[model samples]
Target: MYILLILAAITAINLGKAFGTEKSITGKSEYALAVDVRVSVPSSAFSCMKKYGYKTVFVRGYDPTGDGKFDSNAVDNIHNANKAGLGTEVFMTPQPRSDKKGSQQLVELYEGLKNGDIKVKTIWVQVTSPVNWFPDTKINIDFLNDILSAAAHYEVKIGLYTNGYDWSQITNNAAADKIMLW
Candidate 1:
Protein backbone atom coordinates (compact mmCIF):
# COMPACT_ATOMS: atom_id res chain seq x y z
CA MET A 1 0.00 0.00 0.00
CA TYR A 2 2.73 2.42 0.92
CA ILE A 3 4.58 1.43 -2.22
CA LEU A 4 1.55 2.18 -4.34
CA LEU A 5 1.30 5.62 -2.83
CA ILE A 6 4.94 6.25 -3.47
CA LEU A 7 4.60 5.13 -7.05
CA ALA A 8 1.49 7.21 -7.55
CA ALA A 9 3.20 10.26 -6.18
CA ILE A 10 6.16 9.68 -8.42
CA THR A 11 3.89 9.27 -11.41
CA ALA A 12 1.95 12.38 -10.50
CA ILE A 13 5.13 14.36 -10.25
CA ASN A 14 6.37 13.02 -13.55
CA LEU A 15 3.09 13.91 -15.19
CA GLY A 16 3.31 17.50 -14.12
CA LYS A 17 6.95 17.63 -14.99
CA ALA A 18 6.01 17.02 -18.60
CA PHE A 19 4.52 20.52 -18.83
CA GLY A 20 7.82 21.97 -17.63
CA THR A 21 8.76 23.20 -14.17
CA GLU A 22 6.80 26.41 -14.28
CA LYS A 23 3.90 27.73 -12.19
CA SER A 24 0.83 26.35 -13.92
CA ILE A 25 -2.79 25.27 -13.61
CA THR A 26 -2.66 23.17 -10.45
CA GLY A 27 -0.09 25.46 -8.80
CA LYS A 28 1.80 22.28 -8.10
CA SER A 29 4.74 20.71 -9.81
CA GLU A 30 3.00 17.37 -9.53
CA TYR A 31 -0.20 16.83 -11.46
CA ALA A 32 -1.66 14.02 -13.53
CA LEU A 33 -3.97 13.47 -16.48
CA ALA A 34 -5.89 10.56 -17.92
CA VAL A 35 -7.79 9.97 -21.16
CA ASP A 36 -10.64 7.57 -21.82
CA VAL A 37 -10.99 5.12 -24.73
CA ARG A 38 -13.27 2.30 -25.79
CA VAL A 39 -13.34 -0.45 -28.38
CA SER A 40 -15.00 1.83 -30.87
CA VAL A 41 -12.20 4.38 -30.64
CA PRO A 42 -9.87 3.48 -33.43
CA SER A 43 -6.10 3.40 -33.11
CA SER A 44 -5.93 6.24 -35.60
CA ALA A 45 -7.37 8.55 -32.99
CA PHE A 46 -4.27 7.97 -30.89
CA SER A 47 -1.93 9.03 -33.66
CA CYS A 48 -1.61 12.35 -31.94
CA MET A 49 -2.18 11.27 -28.32
CA LYS A 50 1.38 12.19 -27.49
CA LYS A 51 0.67 15.80 -28.33
CA TYR A 52 -1.77 16.10 -25.39
CA GLY A 53 1.05 14.98 -23.06
CA TYR A 54 -1.15 12.91 -20.78
CA LYS A 55 0.79 10.65 -18.44
CA THR A 56 -1.93 8.10 -17.91
CA VAL A 57 -4.89 6.70 -19.84
CA PHE A 58 -8.03 4.67 -19.24
CA VAL A 59 -8.76 2.11 -21.92
CA ARG A 60 -11.86 -0.06 -22.08
CA GLY A 61 -11.38 -3.79 -21.80
CA TYR A 62 -14.91 -5.12 -22.00
CA ASP A 63 -18.10 -4.53 -23.94
CA PRO A 64 -21.58 -4.73 -22.42
CA THR A 65 -23.27 -7.85 -23.82
CA GLY A 66 -23.46 -11.14 -25.57
CA ASP A 67 -20.10 -12.81 -24.90
CA GLY A 68 -19.20 -10.07 -22.42
CA LYS A 69 -15.53 -10.43 -23.13
CA PHE A 70 -12.42 -8.51 -24.12
CA ASP A 71 -13.03 -5.61 -26.45
CA SER A 72 -11.66 -6.03 -29.94
CA ASN A 73 -10.12 -2.58 -30.07
CA ALA A 74 -8.43 -2.84 -26.68
CA VAL A 75 -5.15 -4.17 -28.05
CA ASP A 76 -4.94 -1.51 -30.69
CA ASN A 77 -5.57 1.18 -28.12
CA ILE A 78 -2.97 -0.26 -25.82
CA HIS A 79 -0.48 -0.61 -28.61
CA ASN A 80 -1.11 2.90 -29.83
CA ALA A 81 -1.00 4.36 -26.36
CA ASN A 82 2.29 2.64 -25.74
CA LYS A 83 3.52 3.94 -29.00
CA ALA A 84 2.54 7.40 -27.87
CA GLY A 85 4.57 6.87 -24.67
CA LEU A 86 1.65 7.04 -22.27
CA GLY A 87 1.04 4.74 -19.36
CA THR A 88 -2.12 2.72 -19.93
CA GLU A 89 -4.71 1.54 -17.45
CA VAL A 90 -7.64 -0.72 -18.22
CA PHE A 91 -11.25 -0.04 -17.13
CA MET A 92 -14.57 -1.83 -17.37
CA THR A 93 -18.05 -0.36 -17.26
CA PRO A 94 -19.59 -1.81 -14.12
CA GLN A 95 -22.94 -0.17 -13.90
CA PRO A 96 -26.04 -2.27 -13.10
CA ARG A 97 -24.12 -5.23 -11.72
CA SER A 98 -24.17 -7.09 -8.42
CA ASP A 99 -21.15 -7.43 -6.15
CA LYS A 100 -20.56 -11.03 -7.11
CA LYS A 101 -21.09 -10.33 -10.77
CA GLY A 102 -18.97 -7.20 -10.77
CA SER A 103 -16.12 -8.96 -9.06
CA GLN A 104 -16.25 -11.70 -11.62
CA GLN A 105 -16.22 -9.14 -14.36
CA LEU A 106 -13.20 -7.44 -12.88
CA VAL A 107 -11.29 -10.66 -12.70
CA GLU A 108 -12.35 -11.57 -16.18
CA LEU A 109 -11.13 -8.26 -17.48
CA TYR A 110 -7.76 -8.65 -15.80
CA GLU A 111 -7.34 -12.15 -17.10
CA GLY A 112 -8.38 -11.24 -20.60
CA LEU A 113 -5.94 -8.37 -20.77
CA LYS A 114 -3.17 -10.50 -19.33
CA ASN A 115 -3.85 -13.26 -21.84
CA GLY A 116 -3.39 -10.72 -24.55
CA ASP A 117 -0.14 -9.57 -22.92
CA ILE A 118 -1.65 -6.13 -22.45
CA LYS A 119 -0.27 -5.16 -19.08
CA VAL A 120 -1.21 -1.78 -17.72
CA LYS A 121 -0.30 0.80 -15.09
CA THR A 122 -3.55 0.18 -13.16
CA ILE A 123 -7.16 -0.99 -13.22
CA TRP A 124 -10.15 1.31 -12.98
CA VAL A 125 -13.73 0.26 -12.41
CA GLN A 126 -16.55 2.48 -13.61
CA VAL A 127 -19.32 3.19 -11.14
CA THR A 128 -21.39 5.71 -13.06
CA SER A 129 -23.41 5.71 -16.22
CA PRO A 130 -23.03 8.83 -18.34
CA VAL A 131 -26.58 8.47 -19.68
CA ASN A 132 -28.60 7.41 -16.65
CA TRP A 133 -28.81 7.95 -12.93
CA PHE A 134 -27.91 4.81 -11.00
CA PRO A 135 -29.82 5.09 -7.74
CA ASP A 136 -29.04 1.87 -5.90
CA THR A 137 -26.63 2.64 -3.08
CA LYS A 138 -26.54 -0.87 -1.73
CA ILE A 139 -25.65 -2.34 -5.08
CA ASN A 140 -23.02 0.28 -5.76
CA ILE A 141 -21.32 -0.07 -2.39
CA ASP A 142 -21.36 -3.82 -2.62
CA PHE A 143 -19.94 -3.79 -6.08
CA LEU A 144 -17.17 -1.39 -5.09
CA ASN A 145 -16.10 -3.51 -2.14
CA ASP A 146 -15.97 -6.59 -4.28
CA ILE A 147 -13.96 -4.93 -7.01
CA LEU A 148 -11.55 -3.43 -4.50
CA SER A 149 -10.95 -6.83 -2.97
CA ALA A 150 -10.36 -8.41 -6.35
CA ALA A 151 -8.01 -5.61 -7.31
CA ALA A 152 -5.94 -6.17 -4.19
CA HIS A 153 -5.75 -9.85 -4.87
CA TYR A 154 -4.44 -9.11 -8.30
CA GLU A 155 -1.85 -6.80 -6.74
CA VAL A 156 -2.51 -3.94 -9.11
CA LYS A 157 -3.28 -0.30 -8.52
CA ILE A 158 -7.03 0.23 -8.61
CA GLY A 159 -9.29 3.25 -8.93
CA LEU A 160 -12.87 4.26 -9.70
CA TYR A 161 -14.81 6.56 -12.06
CA THR A 162 -17.97 8.25 -10.88
CA ASN A 163 -19.68 11.55 -10.43
CA GLY A 164 -19.60 13.38 -7.08
CA TYR A 165 -22.35 12.01 -4.84
CA ASP A 166 -22.21 8.56 -6.33
CA TRP A 167 -18.60 8.22 -5.27
CA SER A 168 -19.25 8.73 -1.57
CA GLN A 169 -22.41 6.62 -1.60
CA ILE A 170 -21.18 3.85 -3.86
CA THR A 171 -17.78 3.51 -2.23
CA ASN A 172 -19.16 3.97 1.29
CA ASN A 173 -15.90 5.63 2.25
CA ALA A 174 -13.76 2.85 0.92
CA ALA A 175 -10.03 3.62 1.21
CA ALA A 176 -9.03 4.08 -2.36
CA ASP A 177 -6.16 6.46 -2.97
CA LYS A 178 -7.37 7.52 -6.41
CA ILE A 179 -10.89 8.43 -7.51
CA MET A 180 -11.70 9.94 -10.90
CA LEU A 181 -14.77 12.13 -11.07
CA TRP A 182 -17.13 12.87 -13.90
Candidate 2:
Protein backbone atom coordinates (compact mmCIF):
# COMPACT_ATOMS: atom_id res chain seq x y z
CA MET A 1 0.00 0.00 0.00
CA TYR A 2 2.84 2.40 0.91
CA ILE A 3 4.71 1.57 -2.28
CA LEU A 4 1.58 2.27 -4.34
CA LEU A 5 1.13 5.61 -2.59
CA ILE A 6 4.75 6.58 -3.30
CA LEU A 7 4.36 5.66 -6.96
CA ALA A 8 1.22 7.80 -7.25
CA ALA A 9 3.02 10.73 -5.65
CA ILE A 10 5.96 10.36 -8.03
CA THR A 11 3.62 10.19 -11.02
CA ALA A 12 1.80 13.30 -9.90
CA ILE A 13 5.10 15.16 -9.44
CA ASN A 14 6.28 14.10 -12.86
CA LEU A 15 3.05 15.22 -14.44
CA GLY A 16 3.33 18.58 -12.75
CA LYS A 17 6.90 18.91 -13.97
CA ALA A 18 5.81 18.10 -17.52
CA PHE A 19 3.13 20.78 -17.36
CA GLY A 20 5.54 23.50 -16.09
CA THR A 21 4.27 23.45 -12.52
CA GLU A 22 7.86 22.59 -11.65
CA LYS A 23 8.74 26.19 -12.33
CA SER A 24 6.68 27.17 -9.33
CA ILE A 25 8.53 24.62 -7.26
CA THR A 26 12.00 25.52 -8.49
CA GLY A 27 11.33 29.27 -8.73
CA LYS A 28 13.07 29.46 -12.08
CA SER A 29 13.01 32.15 -14.70
CA GLU A 30 9.82 31.65 -16.71
CA TYR A 31 9.57 34.99 -18.49
CA ALA A 32 12.20 37.24 -19.98
CA LEU A 33 12.77 40.30 -17.78
CA ALA A 34 11.76 43.56 -19.40
CA VAL A 35 10.60 46.89 -17.96
CA ASP A 36 7.84 48.59 -19.97
CA VAL A 37 8.24 51.97 -18.24
CA ARG A 38 4.56 52.58 -18.71
CA VAL A 39 1.92 53.08 -16.04
CA SER A 40 2.59 50.01 -13.92
CA VAL A 41 2.13 46.30 -13.89
CA PRO A 42 -0.39 44.49 -11.77
CA SER A 43 0.56 42.89 -8.47
CA SER A 44 0.65 39.45 -10.05
CA ALA A 45 3.43 40.42 -12.43
CA PHE A 46 5.39 41.92 -9.58
CA SER A 47 4.96 38.77 -7.52
CA CYS A 48 6.03 36.47 -10.34
CA MET A 49 9.13 38.48 -11.17
CA LYS A 50 9.96 38.67 -7.51
CA LYS A 51 9.75 34.90 -7.25
CA TYR A 52 11.90 34.38 -10.32
CA GLY A 53 15.32 35.89 -10.77
CA TYR A 54 14.07 38.37 -13.37
CA LYS A 55 16.97 40.75 -13.93
CA THR A 56 15.04 43.15 -16.13
CA VAL A 57 11.49 44.52 -16.21
CA PHE A 58 9.76 46.96 -18.54
CA VAL A 59 7.63 49.94 -17.41
CA ARG A 60 5.11 51.52 -19.77
CA GLY A 61 2.67 54.46 -20.25
CA TYR A 62 4.79 56.93 -18.38
CA ASP A 63 3.54 60.48 -18.73
CA PRO A 64 6.21 63.12 -19.19
CA THR A 65 4.35 65.95 -17.56
CA GLY A 66 3.59 65.96 -13.88
CA ASP A 67 0.41 67.94 -14.52
CA GLY A 68 -0.82 65.61 -17.25
CA LYS A 69 0.21 68.15 -19.83
CA PHE A 70 1.95 65.85 -22.32
CA ASP A 71 2.26 62.61 -20.48
CA SER A 72 1.86 63.63 -16.88
CA ASN A 73 2.22 60.14 -15.53
CA ALA A 74 5.56 59.38 -17.16
CA VAL A 75 7.83 61.25 -14.80
CA ASP A 76 6.92 59.07 -11.86
CA ASN A 77 7.36 55.98 -14.01
CA ILE A 78 10.88 56.93 -15.04
CA HIS A 79 11.74 57.51 -11.43
CA ASN A 80 10.18 54.19 -10.50
CA ALA A 81 12.20 52.28 -13.13
CA ASN A 82 15.38 54.00 -12.04
CA LYS A 83 14.72 53.03 -8.45
CA ALA A 84 14.13 49.44 -9.51
CA GLY A 85 17.38 49.36 -11.54
CA LEU A 86 15.60 48.64 -14.81
CA GLY A 87 16.64 50.26 -18.06
CA THR A 88 14.03 52.59 -19.55
CA GLU A 89 12.96 53.29 -23.11
CA VAL A 90 10.42 56.06 -23.58
CA PHE A 91 7.66 55.22 -26.05
CA MET A 92 6.43 58.46 -27.60
CA THR A 93 2.84 58.28 -28.77
CA PRO A 94 1.86 60.21 -31.87
CA GLN A 95 -0.34 63.25 -31.19
CA PRO A 96 -1.38 65.93 -33.65
CA ARG A 97 0.86 68.95 -33.22
CA SER A 98 -1.30 70.93 -35.67
CA ASP A 99 -3.62 71.88 -32.80
CA LYS A 100 -3.19 73.46 -29.39
CA LYS A 101 -3.71 70.19 -27.52
CA GLY A 102 -1.15 68.45 -29.67
CA SER A 103 1.24 71.35 -29.40
CA GLN A 104 0.98 71.01 -25.66
CA GLN A 105 1.71 67.34 -26.02
CA LEU A 106 4.80 68.20 -28.03
CA VAL A 107 5.92 70.51 -25.28
CA GLU A 108 5.34 67.70 -22.85
CA LEU A 109 7.45 65.41 -25.00
CA TYR A 110 10.29 67.92 -25.03
CA GLU A 111 9.98 68.37 -21.30
CA GLY A 112 10.04 64.62 -20.76
CA LEU A 113 13.36 64.33 -22.51
CA LYS A 114 14.85 67.46 -21.08
CA ASN A 115 13.97 66.77 -17.46
CA GLY A 116 14.68 63.06 -17.52
CA ASP A 117 18.15 61.65 -17.52
CA ILE A 118 19.89 60.53 -20.70
CA LYS A 119 19.21 56.92 -19.71
CA VAL A 120 16.50 56.82 -22.39
CA LYS A 121 18.70 55.26 -25.08
CA THR A 122 15.82 54.34 -27.35
CA ILE A 123 12.69 56.33 -28.17
CA TRP A 124 9.90 54.21 -29.65
CA VAL A 125 7.20 55.96 -31.64
CA GLN A 126 3.95 54.26 -30.57
CA VAL A 127 1.89 53.74 -33.72
CA THR A 128 0.00 50.69 -32.67
CA SER A 129 -3.48 49.49 -33.81
CA PRO A 130 -6.53 51.77 -33.80
CA VAL A 131 -4.16 54.69 -33.30
CA ASN A 132 -2.06 53.07 -36.02
CA TRP A 133 -3.67 54.74 -39.01
CA PHE A 134 -2.60 58.30 -39.69
CA PRO A 135 -4.95 60.91 -41.20
CA ASP A 136 -2.57 61.05 -44.11
CA THR A 137 0.77 59.43 -44.81
CA LYS A 138 2.30 62.89 -44.73
CA ILE A 139 0.83 63.52 -41.31
CA ASN A 140 2.54 60.50 -39.91
CA ILE A 141 5.75 61.27 -41.73
CA ASP A 142 5.81 64.85 -40.58
CA PHE A 143 5.10 63.89 -36.96
CA LEU A 144 7.77 61.23 -36.99
CA ASN A 145 10.18 63.66 -38.60
CA ASP A 146 9.56 66.23 -35.93
CA ILE A 147 10.14 63.71 -33.16
CA LEU A 148 13.23 62.34 -34.86
CA SER A 149 14.63 65.80 -35.30
CA ALA A 150 13.95 66.55 -31.66
CA ALA A 151 15.64 63.33 -30.57
CA ALA A 152 18.62 63.93 -32.82
CA HIS A 153 19.00 67.43 -31.48
CA TYR A 154 18.79 66.02 -27.95
CA GLU A 155 21.47 63.38 -28.73
CA VAL A 156 19.02 60.52 -28.41
CA LYS A 157 18.25 58.01 -31.15
CA ILE A 158 14.72 57.54 -32.55
CA GLY A 159 13.10 54.29 -33.63
CA LEU A 160 9.86 53.77 -35.56
CA TYR A 161 7.45 51.46 -33.77
CA THR A 162 4.86 50.06 -36.14
CA ASN A 163 3.59 47.01 -37.97
CA GLY A 164 5.63 45.75 -40.92
CA TYR A 165 3.85 47.74 -43.64
CA ASP A 166 4.00 51.04 -41.81
CA TRP A 167 7.61 50.49 -40.89
CA SER A 168 8.42 49.60 -44.50
CA GLN A 169 6.65 52.71 -45.68
CA ILE A 170 8.69 54.92 -43.34
CA THR A 171 12.10 53.33 -43.97
CA ASN A 172 12.12 53.48 -47.76
CA ASN A 173 13.97 56.79 -48.07
CA ALA A 174 14.27 60.04 -46.11
CA ALA A 175 12.68 58.45 -43.05
CA ALA A 176 15.56 56.19 -42.15
CA ASP A 177 17.55 57.19 -39.11
CA LYS A 178 17.85 55.09 -35.93
CA ILE A 179 14.68 53.07 -36.15
CA MET A 180 13.72 50.84 -33.20
CA LEU A 181 12.16 48.63 -35.92
CA TRP A 182 9.52 46.71 -33.96
- For candidate 2, what is the lDDT? 0.49
Tens digits of per-residue lDDT, candidate 1, 44-156, equal 45545556555765678866565356577677778777777777777777644432366677777888878778765477666655333235666556666776778778876
Q: Which regions in candidate 1 have their CA more than 4 angstroms from the true location?
A: 1-34, 40-44, 52-55, 65-68, 98-100, 130-134, 168-182
Query: Candidate 2 lDDT, tens digit per residue, 65-119?
Result: 3333445556565565455555446666655433434334444566665676535
Error (Å) of candidate 2 at residue 144 is 0.9
Candidate number of the best lDDT: 1
Report clashes for each candidate as comma-separated counts: 0, 22
User: 19, model 2: CA deviation in Å?
Assistant: 39
